[model samples]
Target: MASNTGNAFDFNLFKRLLKYTNPYKGTFYFVGVAAVLLSFFSVLRPYLLQVTIDDAIMPSDNEGLVFYVALMLGVLLLEVISQFLFIYYANWLGQEVVRDLRVNLFEHMLKFKMKYFDKSAVGRLVTRAVSDIETISSIFSQGLFMIISDLLKMLVVLGFMFYKSWQLTLLVLTVLPFIIYATRVFQKKMKVAFEDVRNQVADLNTFVQERITGMKIVQLFTREKAEYEKFKGINDKHRKAWVKTVWYNSIFFPIAEMSTSITIGLIVWFGGLRAIENDSLSLGVIIMFIELSQMLFRPLRQIADKFNTLQMGMVAANRVFGILDTRSFISDEGSREVGKLNGKIEFKDVHFSYVDDEEVLKGVSFKANPGETVAIVGATGAGKSTVINLLNRFYEIDSGQILVDDIDIKDVKLKSLRSQIAVVLQNVFLFADTIMSNITLDHPDITEEDVITAAKQIGIHEFINTLPNGYHYNVKERGVMLSSGQRQLISFLRAYVSNPSILVLDEATSSVDSYSEQLIQDATDKITEGRTSIVIAHRLATIKKADKIIVMDAGRIVEIGNHEQLLQQKDGYYKKLYEVQFMAEESLRS
Candidate 1:
């Protein structure tokens, strides 16, 4: 996360934000014109009142008074229309900009490397995508145009006051320096308060989202009381952040009101004393100055509040731009668009790490020939999963080359390379959608008939048919509706339907029951018939029939041969792993 510690009114950042309005330039210009028209209309009414008092009402001219009153009403109607258009178009433009910004932000996040997500919090990103962008919208709808419109109205009102009487206008000016100094102090304090408010909002959202997502864990471990305490602490911080803004508002508004009232009193006192002695200063002029004083001071008072809106928007824009400017995505510079790949893969001197100076794979090299099944066995944290992740370019390698069909994988287009491979993991993730939708992922090319055909081939068709609505059955979030075994079967069937040239199964059968294990094995046998396959598993019995087995320790391969060949070696890694681990499990199951 980035913190903004500079001036609140950042023009460069503001200029960058304005670029989003380029798409709706016509609306932007229309809103600007409406603001200007509103300012002009706002001042015309008070001038008409001055004229009606001096030129029509006092002289007892009935016809002149009627004409002037009618003109004043007409100006009021125009001002109302202008206000409506200004508000409507400004908000419409704000929503349009927000819609575009949200789309662009989402698309940018989708391309980021998996490593970036590994270090970032899900809820903070959600806050940026949703809540922060919403704050930026206020910049257009309330902050920018509203402030401009108010300032213009003040300027026009001041011009009319001075034209009527310089003496009265200077009296109004006498109180402004104090109000302006208070407003500046208020703005500086509010900027810091708003930044704190935004930070607290992100923290509250992150805490609540994580707790809700893992609610079962909280309850299962009897941690409800502890989690509630943590939540209360966070919620209290959020409340305190908002209260600071309210505190500043309470202090500032009263000062603004006092100054305006005193200025109005002075104008009346001075103008009244002059009107009684001389014919030059008339009663109409005094009344006009009173109305004009409010017109000028009211905006000055409200402008500080609107300026705070702009400050908050700038803070949000800074955070959003931080994410947008990140250079964490995999470089998709490959131009090779090979339609379909032949399933031959080789890792040559692959050295990689998730973090600097902490290598997970050190000069690890292996090759799986076309249409061969290679099983990789290793202990936890032994670089088994890192190999699969590297193959898919989820993260770039520090140094080495991964080749598919003798062409370097880095030279192949990312989507083209990934489309040829499929993976089914130990933990299956299914959306809160229909089973068929989860399987096809709404690929547009895949149909219900195709899914059913693939399901039957994988031997899970009977199981799916037993459920209500069959393929249409909703699998809720993370497939909680189904048992662990049933979810694994869905994942296996999903991988089979993709029909990739290479399939990687990472402990796909480890946690399931006997029935699902048998079904997954059947699906694995059917799917890996002619395609190149790489299986990573802890259960040695499952991979006993694999054409080749690679035993890894620490970060390097220590053994490579057929199952029997590796088992025949005296005190070998695989032989000890099999005898000490799966042999006991197999006996217990029997």
Candidate 2:
């Protein structure tokens, strides 16, 4: 996203966010109430200064001084107590808000259609979900709290100062507009700077994630030096952004300090002249002005800093709210009226694209019987993947009707719709948990037997047996602890565990060895015997055994037949693909 979505802060999004954290109203309200109490205690410092000058120092009465000193001490204790409450609540609220925001953002992201992920950059998503939300939490917790309490303290102090002497108070008040103007200007610049900072951070994060994931490739190709240089470039960009942010901070603080200092100097000069004349000005009034002037500085500094924080946080808020603002392309009416599917699928004249500039699947039409293996074969970017993606309602077709058992797939609730189907994509994602837990995805109250059953069926039980912990072995993030083939098999087992009515294997066996592939192929056939199965593959051997094959080129289906029929059409695209694969296999055999 943009700096500010639609140029308005979007209160509706803010309200919706509050709904999730509203369960913690006790903590939120306590922070607010504690802040007001802190403001009340802040007003007493000037009161103490006035009493010391009027009752003790001015008249030289040591007897009355002790009582005032004790009173000041008591107020100090109250201030301490209030400050404690403020700190505790603000910290608690900050961490809690961050937790809640992360949860909400992730939950919303998961609910989105696959097309949303396809369009989003992982780096940008991480920035908004993590650092951006952190900025917002800081603002909501401590920043928002301090702004209100300090503003109230400033107002109360101003009232007290004016009552002591309106003349000096007005002189002090003259600097108010300058502070406000400076804050406004500085805040605008800081917001823009921090936005760049966030982007640079995202660039750097992407570099790090890619480097770590591709460490093997970098090592094998001896490209570490080149990769390091590329990484340093982004890292340097991030450094410059952070440096600029510091400079903006440096300028705002001093300017604010100097303005308040000038106001204080003027007040002192006026107060001193009045006292020399021995006019109505008492020492108490002069001392009070001095103390109040200092008090004004604290809030002035706070307000200036707060404005800068608000600016930086606005970028974060906008990004977070932007995620919340996104309306998924495919929406269910929440009317979970559809029951189990009948396995019949129809794609009628579908036209689709990831972006409007180019279409991926164009005017594709097909039908699948209840229990048939329909294999799709195409060159990369020729719309083989797009066909299954449409079936899953990942992207809404520009124009088409995808009927599942006579009901438009879009009409079914997303959760209900997805739960009825299982997909094993080319890349598998395994969690950092026990193999059993990963198989069940930590489904609560699920027994180990449920996992063992799926494992045995997918032929991964033998592999799990070799591990020391067996079912208890932890699969590190993305299953890094397992070999590629093992991870693939475990993923297959996980899918089989779900027992979905419609099974989609998108190059499922492409990563497996021949022996494992055979075992999986046997399992696939046995399991999908009376269910709908769709396979997308480039390997001609795999699909040769499929009941039907659809040959596609450039988003359109050019031919369709059983294995033998496509071979008879010798001049077609399928024949060329078949010949290439056959030759490759023959060479391997030789």
- Against the reference, the lDDT scores of all candidates come to 0.89, 0.78
In candidate 1, what are the lDDT values of residues 25-106, reduced to their tens digit? 9999999999999988878888899889999999999999999999998899988988999999999999999999999999
Off by over 4 Å in 2: 1-33, 174-177, 334-342, 444-446, 508-511, 538-541, 570-572, 586-590
| Backbone clashes in model 2, listed as residue pairs | none
* Candidate closest to the true structure, highest TM-score: 1
Best by lDDT: 1
> Across residues 1-590, which tens digit of lDDT does each residue of candidate 2 receive?
35453232335555654565586789878878877777767778777868887879779988888878888899899889888888888777778878887887898888788878877777778888988888877676656678888888888888888777898988887887888788767766776787788779878877787788779999999999999899888889999999998998899889888987797788778888998886778778777787787777778788667755655666677778788889875666746555667788888999998889698888998888887888998788899888878788777789989988878887888778877788877887888888888778776756788878767766668878999799899988888898766776776777787877788887655566887666666666655667788888645555877888888999999999888998899697888888887568657747
Total clashes, candidate 2?
Answer: 0
**Deviation of model 1 at 72, angstroms:** 2.3
Cα RMSD, each candidate: 1.6, 3.2
Candidate 1 segments whose C-alpha is farther than 4 A from its true place? 1-6, 60-63
